[model samples]
Target: MALSTSNRAAPSSYLSLGEVAAELGITDRTVRNYVARGVLPAHRIKGSRLIRVRRSDVDALLQPVPVTDGGDAA
Candidate 1:
């Protein structure tokens, strides 16, 4: 018998608070604040009190900064 493969992508792994902070170049407290403010979504582990965030969620926080051209205005 041959195994069947699906065209679906694998699920993303969860990230710890520290990991999320490092990824965003921010402090863990900031990450916690984001979670508290409902800006970032977090999940609780099934059997533990530990909380985790998805990489996709972290990536979602990344937004392109608007660049302004240095020009003199009259």
Candidate 2:
């Protein structure tokens, strides 16, 4: 008998909960809250609590708000 393996690699978009939290300067609990509130998308691995989020999805949520002229600038 011999062990077998493939050269396939994991998706680049997915990141750990801690990675997302650290990038946002927040805590894991806060990240979990965002997931719970439906503000962010997450997926938990089957048979375990390991959560992963798409980098694109997280980046979308962190996009900077556009500034508009209110005609009141001093």
The backbone clash count of each candidate, in order, is 0, 0
Model 1 clashes, total count: 0
Q: Which one wins on TM-score?
A: 2
Best by lDDT: 2
Tens-digit per-residue lDDT, 1-74, candidate 1: 11123333324576788999998999999988888888888776555656777788788889676889879877
The sequence of per-residue lDDT tens digits that candidate 2 reaches over residues 9-42 is: 3266777879999988999999888888878887
Q: Tell me the TM-score of each prediction against the true structure.
A: 0.67, 0.69
What global local distance difference test value does model 1 have? Answer: 0.74
For model 1 the local lDDT of residue 16 reads: 80
Candidate 1: misplaced stretches above 4 Å? 1-12, 65-74
After TM-score superposition, the amount by which residue 25's alpha carbon in candidate 2 deviates from its true location, in angstroms, is 0.9
Error of model 2, residue 39, in angstroms: 0.4
